[model samples]
Target chain A: MTVLEFDRITKIYNVRGAGQMKALDEVSFTLESGRTLGLVGQSGSGKSTIAKILTQLETPTTGRVLLDGEPIPRHGKALRSYRQQLRMVFQDPFASLNPYHSIRYHIERPLQLDRVVPADQVDAEVRRLLERVRLDADSVIDRRPHELSGGQRQRVAIARALASRPKLLVADEPVSMLDVSIRLGVLNLLADLQREEGLGVLYITHDLATARHFSDEIMVLNQGRVVERGPADEVILNPQDPYTRELRAASPDPEKHFATAARDQGGAR
Target chain B: MSDALLTVRDFSVVYDVDPPVAAVKDVTLELRRGEILGLAGESGCGKTTLAYGVQRLLKAPAVITSGSVVFHDASGADIDVNSLDAEQMRRFRWDKVSMVFQGAMNALNPVAPIGRQLEDVFEVHRPAMSRAKRRAEVAELLEIVKVGAARARSFPHELSGGMRQRVMIAMALALRPQLMVMDEPTTALDVLVQREILRQISQLRHEFGFSVIFITHDLPLLLEISDRIAIMREGEIVELDTAERIWTDPQDGYTKTLLSSFPRLTGERGVVVR
Candidate 1:
């Protein structure tokens, strides 16, 4: 079993005119192969920073990320292996995918790069990966990203991430770009894959409802600080920090009937 | 006299391609006086197409096939929108109806200061207004959306995503138009900011009494703010009713599926998706 530990990571970005900005501050958390951790925050709350740190897109200012109690390799074959173990599913599938390439080429690139299967079996594995994501392999494999719907394109992206057979998946707002009707579908597909494959997932999003529902644990971030972290229900239903509470109040609760329709609409918020 | 602020009959938008795909097929709708009407649908379901068609904002390749849009002015003047010429259409747009689209960067000019851009709205629409009055109005519009007046000096790039969206909203509100058609205005914003913006929109409607066509794929948000909701699917409006009814007892099977798409904060999760 794989255990990833993020130890006291701090990332400070040197903004063009603003000099320096702390994107993350002394943030630390543990992710295990069999569980999911929801990283919840607003746009500039440093949620993406954590994802960047994990994927090695940005180096930490003062801390380290350890996989199985060892520091991650910086470069060469070890770095490639580290990447194979940790994969990312970006938010915008439309932009993430290339318009020119067919879906087969997109998924095949990852499989070939990782050598997930031999030459002759590559075609079969591509079909299998597409099927695993619950997409109709025959219908979509030959089509370009533009030909597919937002949901279908996202499913293909998930299939591509799973192509590496990673131990961990860093999904940064995976469904936020898709239409609301199709968001839950992509999310459920991710959750099902996590359950079936025992892949540790860092589900990063500004949405609390989905986080509480899908994650085993929820970590709240505010302006680069980890304000609260606990069991998903505890963190969401009974938030300790004011930031989390504010976030909860802001999110439109589908079950909470708005008394605005009844009254003068003063407290619709 | 009808209580309807706007009436649309037999509206359809067809793209001129080989087979000629109908993006919006005969969508008949109405906006009640001073009510927030929610247009909910997935992407490519023709929600945007209907909004664009209503405002006559749609350009070539996509043509309005069979439709009539009539705007019922509060002064008892009924203006048939489709017959207006270019100059008349321009004057009618911001003066009678304003639209906030996705509420993002492309909505504003990156080169000019926000203050100048807001002033330009008055210059172009209300040509005779004094410079000082335009500046004061810009500040007031900025205040209404809760953005600091200091942001007026900054360009679009200098402002945060949420701030830029609020500025777009400020621009939309400048004309005091009878109808505001906002297409996914808060979709890109964070949840906290989104709620705040919605609250502002709701409050502003109460204050100004301008009717709104709030379009988004987010159904729950529609339930929160909209008095009535319209559900569109495959270029046609399948269901249109009070928001409460849409939420509690969705009649159409497609509406039921759309309602069940979101993961609820309470109760059993994913009634359909799971």
Candidate 2:
């Protein structure tokens, strides 16, 4: 079983005039295969910083991340090999996808680079990946990113991420840009794929409700510090941290909001 | 005064593209005074098109094909919105109806102090007001939105995202318009900030007694604050009702689908919302 451990990752940024700014403070967590960990916080909470550090975009000021108990390689083939095992899914599908590249090309490059399949089987692998994401491979293969809707584009992104056959997937705000109606379908597909592949998934989003719904565990970050972490239901239903409670309270849950509103109106009358 | 502050009758808008497409089709709705009317739909559903058509804000290829939008002026006049000329429309716009667009915070001038930008509203519309009076009006407006009178001197970039959004709301309320059209006003903000903005809007509406047209794809958000909601699908309004009714007993299949789209905080992991 594959295990990804993020141990005490702290990131400090040197601002122009602001001196040292702590973007992340001693944040630590772990994810095992077949489990989903939801990282949630407001903007500037350093949730994205964790994703960046994991992807090697930014090095931690202190602490380190280990995959299978091995430090991530700094450069060359080892770094490339390390990257091959962990892939990223960005937030905006429209921007993340290349406008000039065909959907087939987007899915094929990762497979070709990672050499997941033989050169002859690359086309078939692309088809399989597209089909896995529930897209019609025959129809969407030649189309550009703009040709597909936002939901379809995001699905293509997921397929591309899976093309590498990574053990851990870091999805940063996957469906935040999508229309609310189609977000469920995409999320359900991701959940299904996660279970089927036994992939350790890091679902990062600011949306508390969805985090609670999809994640096995929820971690709350506040201004670059881990404020709360626990089982999803426990954290959401009876949050220990005041920040988590405020987030839960602020989230627009119709059932809770309406029920409370009705009681308050009744009491007022 | 009539309860209906604004009535849109048989309104339609079409994009003058190759083989022309009808973006909004025969949409009829009324905004009651002091009520928050929500227009909800997915992208390309024509809710935005209908709103733009009502305000004659569509430019170029987008044209209003048919119907009239009438405003029930508090001065006991039924003003035909489409008939107003350029100057009259300008006067009619900020003076009677204002808009807070999606990502409107970015619309502020970066070089100018936010206070100066707010004062420009009075400078242009209330042309006879002195400069000092305009500044004070802007300070008062800023305070009303809780951006603080001191923030007037600060540039747009100086304020946080939520504060910048509040500044936009202050600008919209500068003229004290009777109707405010907010198209996805708080969609860009975080959950906590979004709730704060919504609460501020609700409170302001209570004090000012002005109607609001809030548009977004988020049905749960509308269900939280909107008094009445119009569910649009494929350029047509399929359902219109109170938020409580829409939440409890949605009539249209599309509306039901939209409501169920949100993943609930408590329920089966893969399926169903609360």
Candidate 3:
């Protein structure tokens, strides 16, 4: 089943002195249940714009978004209900989390706001959620955001997002701010969560290598348009678009391919 | 590459809080002329702290507890950066050694025009030069970084992220410093833009004959560009070797684990047993 469908979405911003900017242009894609769609793009490629639209933070200029085959209402009671089914984990964990609040408060507020559990049961649910994200409940519950490391703070953000028990998740460059050594661990956690919860995820990133490893389907966006879309492996290995090929070639390789290429040229000389 | 252009010996940085915390401990490394030295570590591993220590940019809360950073100047004078006063250090900062910071978007002033920012650097450092000569030099600097001269008139907000990064590089390269310290310069950019920026930095180093201290967490990127790689763990340098040796035979367990954590595109998934 299609958990989320975006049909012909476009976003235009009008500048007062400058002309209008077309941020997103007629983008269309479908995210299936229990699968991940990796949206790959550069800084201005409308990847973040799509994530905001999916999370209902911003309305598209022209298009419709459907959740489980029903159109999401623009405002009022129905929109609030639709929002309860989707949640977003922002790119910057340091900025997304409140500095003054404890981890327990951050996690429990979402549960209480959504009315996911009773006041007495909210503490237990928060602890369970913390454990689900591999954070120790006793050690981490009372600590503030400043006390935790970047990775730990991100895991708390993830737990807070999962507190709603939403069917769909939109993670916008979740690990880009993290260190390289811990990035894979977080990616692994996200993949495991998707598998266990059977949640549809829109994984947005500019890193093709990680997207290829993590996502079932990949969509390459360039200048507000879908340049290529297919199975993640197929699109990465056999990229049809020149833009996609350039992006792939630019990515750093762990196997020292460039050094070998330089060595081969030297040997030939 | 010859004997170290910059030698950091037994360097340690401590934060003077209510209780002191050592950010960098007994770290030692060398950067040769016209060679790139890559510093790799996780967050809070003191990579940035080490960079700040070298330039004496660390403020009051952070104190240099011990050791010295010696820079071999163009006239063959060995200057200890730690001993320099604020006025002397200001003169040495951009004229002899420069820095290109991460998040070029935030580094540039939003209200100021790009040309004016570049002119400010020239005005402070090279006040003897004529205004027209300064403009020509600014245009040349922009051209060297592949940014058009027309962009000098535009504000920081008018340019894209990649373009702003190029402007940052141009500003750093304006005075033709002997050494450049880049702290995660391309982390905020995309893959293609990152590659382009790295290639430009490599070319600039070749043209100008300045050494580089490149700090980043991306091992693959460091392997691609650096001549020597130094792995930092907690508060110390764990391993310092050539890029080839560091990749194949890392000495420390933490270094090995960091190398193994990178997800491979064309190999067995998670086969890198730490």
Candidate 3 docks at the CAPRI level of: medium
How much is B105 displaced in model 1, in angstroms? 2.9
CA lDDT of every candidate? 0.90, 0.91, 0.88
Every candidate's DockQ is: 0.58, 0.59, 0.49
User: Clashing pairs in model 3?
Assistant: none
lDDT per residue as tens, model 2, B161-244? 899999999999999999999999998898989989999999999999999999999887899899999999989999999999
What lDDT tens digits, residue by residue, belong to model 3 across residues B131-199?
A: 999999988888888888877899999888889999999999999999999999999888988999999
Lowest lDDT 10-residue stretch of candidate 2 chain B: B265-274
Residue B88 lDDT in model 1? 91
Best first by lDDT, ranked: 2, 1, 3
Tens digits of per-residue lDDT for model 3 on A11-48?
99897998998888999999876899999988788998
User: Which residues of candidate 2, in runs, are more than 4 Å off?
Assistant: A265-269, B272-274
Most lDDT-accurate candidate: 2
| Top of the candidates by DockQ | 2
Residues A1-269, candidate 2: write the lDDT tens digits: 98988899889999998899999999899988888999999988998889999999899999989989999889999999889989998999999999999999999999999899999999999999999999999999999999999999999999999999999999999999998888988888889899899988999998888888888999999999889999988999999999999998888888887778779888621
Candidate 1 error regions (>4 Å): A259-269, B270-274
Per-residue lDDT of candidate 1, residues A46-160 (tens digit): 9888888898988999999999999999889899999999999999999999999999999999899989899899999999999999999999999999999889999999999
Q: Judged by DockQ cut-offs, is candidate 1 incorrect, acceptable, medium or high?
A: medium
By TM-score: ranked, best first: 2, 1, 3
